[model samples]
Target: MKRTTLAIALAVLAWTAWDTGADPIRLGRGIPWLLDFVRRMLPPDLRVLPAALVGALKTVEIALLGTAMAAALALPLGFLSARNVASPAVFHPARVALNFFRSIDTLVYALVFVAAVGLGPFPGVLAVVAYTTTSLAKLYSEAIEGIDRGPVDAITATGATRLQILRYGVLPQVLPLFLSYVLYRLETNIRAATILGFVGAGGIGFYLQTYLRMIDYRAASTVLLVTVVMVMVVDAVSSRLRARLI
Candidate 1:
């Protein structure tokens, strides 16, 4: 059985390699081009620093707002999707909706919103909100489902209302986990928001794309540096928050 499993895995790997065109020889041959690209990007244009900084700030704004909105929307949806909190009929369709949303990539959401709203940070914010809503809802539901039922039953025995039972029982158990998940998703949304600008959704990515298209490697590097710094700062802050909450 082990041998058969290994053979199947090997076959899948081989097929993946071929399908993806993972050519070691091609990569080796591209070394010079890669080096040239890097060399051209050196000594980034400081002139663009101001613009890059603004773009970076926008990216963070989009990500932060997206995470906040998504968390708000996900809270009730999470309850609906939780097996213990909701009946099978309610949870089944809820789970299916979440699965459908989660299946679509964040970039795809950005594209749709961009088309609807016409290019800007608005679309990026919308994209992050839409994608993170489903992702966080699923996580929140799983957290809710995994919580101990002791407190729930105890509350019910006291003839507590549904809201009271959740408040006294479930909230205490899952609040920390849910907050941690929100922080983690905030970190992820920051990264996704940065790239949303590539499609005109707005942020450093748009400037980066513009510079790259214009062959202004130094300007592109400046934008990229700003993006990295912004991401690092957010990650550090988010880590601290999660540590405190968790």
Candidate 2:
């Protein structure tokens, strides 16, 4: 049986490789171009520090606002989607809704919001909120499912309603995990907001895009460097906070 299973797995892998058009030669052609691009990016310019700093702050604001909005909306939706909280009849539909939202990328969300909001930090914030909500809701629901049931059962035995049980039993167990997830999402949103600016959603990415359009590699390099540093700082802080919470 073990040998048969191994043969089947190898056969499936080989078939998938062929089906996906996994050609080593085609992949190798991109390496030279990538190397040339990296070579040009070396010794990043720092002359545009002042402008970069301003843009970096805008990006941070967009990310923070967006993540906060997402958390507020997701906290409730997460409970609705959790298997432990939701009835079986509702669970499938709720899960499907969450999955549908998660399927869309933040960049795509930014594009839609940009059209609707007419290009600004507002649109960028909305985009981040959409993406972050889907992510947090799914993760939060999973965390809920993973929690111990004893507390919930005990609360129910006391004649507590579902909402009461959730408030008294479920929330206490999941709050730390939820907070950790929120911090992680905020870190991710910072990077996403930077990219959204390229679409005129407003952030440091806008400056980077403007410089690139004018072929001002030095200015673009400065913006990129500042953006990277900002993201690194936010990520470090978020990681520490998440560690403390979880």
Candidate 3:
């Protein structure tokens, strides 16, 4: 089994090298230019610091709004998708829809929304929502399905309504897991929200692209620095929150 696994890994590596047109000789020749580019980006322009700060705030806002919207919508859809909570007829169709949403990349959703709404943070928010909704729904349904069937069966035997069963039996079991999923997704959306601006979805990424295009390497470097710091801060805070919750 180990030999078979090693053979498959080697075959995959060879296919990747062939498909990507990777050339070690070309990379070796490009090293000097790469070093030169990094050299130019140093001593990042402090003049753009204020603008970068504003862009960072905007990125956080987009992520927060997107995550909130996705969580709100996912709650009902997730319940409907859970086999324990929903019949096959309801859950099967719901699962199909969730799969369809999951198949599309968030950036592609951003492009469509940008074209429809004509740009701004709104499109970025919508894109993240569309992608996160499906992801959270799938996660939440699995959590629901994994709950102790004993409580669910006992609750049902008590002549409890479906809603009551959900409240007393299923929700208590799954809420913590659901909260953890939301926190993790918030961290992910923060990073995703940064790039949505590239397609005019609105964020610091637009400024990054602009500075690079104008050969303003110092300003671009400042933006890159701010982006990195923002992501680090968010990740640290979310990690703490997740630890406490779990």
Could you say which candidate leads in TM-score? Answer: 1
Query: Each prediction's TM-score against the native?
Result: 0.96, 0.85, 0.94
User: Considering lDDT, where higher is better, how would the candidates rank from best to worst?
Assistant: 1, 3, 2
lDDT digits (tens) for residues 123-159 of candidate 3: 9999999999999999999999899999888999999
User: Tens digit of lDDT per residue, candidate 1, span 74-184?
Assistant: 999999999999999999999999999999988999999999989899989999989999999999999999999999999999999999999998999999999999999
Better of 1 and 3 by TM-score: 1
TM-score of 3: 0.94
Clashes of 3: 0
Worst 10 residues of 1 by lDDT: 197-206
How close to the true structure is residue 92 of candidate 1, measured as C-alpha lDDT?
A: 98
Cα displacement (angstroms), candidate 2, residue 222, comes to 0.9
RMSD in angstroms between candidate 1 and the native structure over all alpha carbons: 1.2
Clashes of each: 0, 0, 0
Clashing pairs in 2: none
> After aligning candidate 3 to the native by TM-score, how far in Å is the CA of 172 from where it should be?
1.0
**How big is the RMSD of model 2?**
3.2
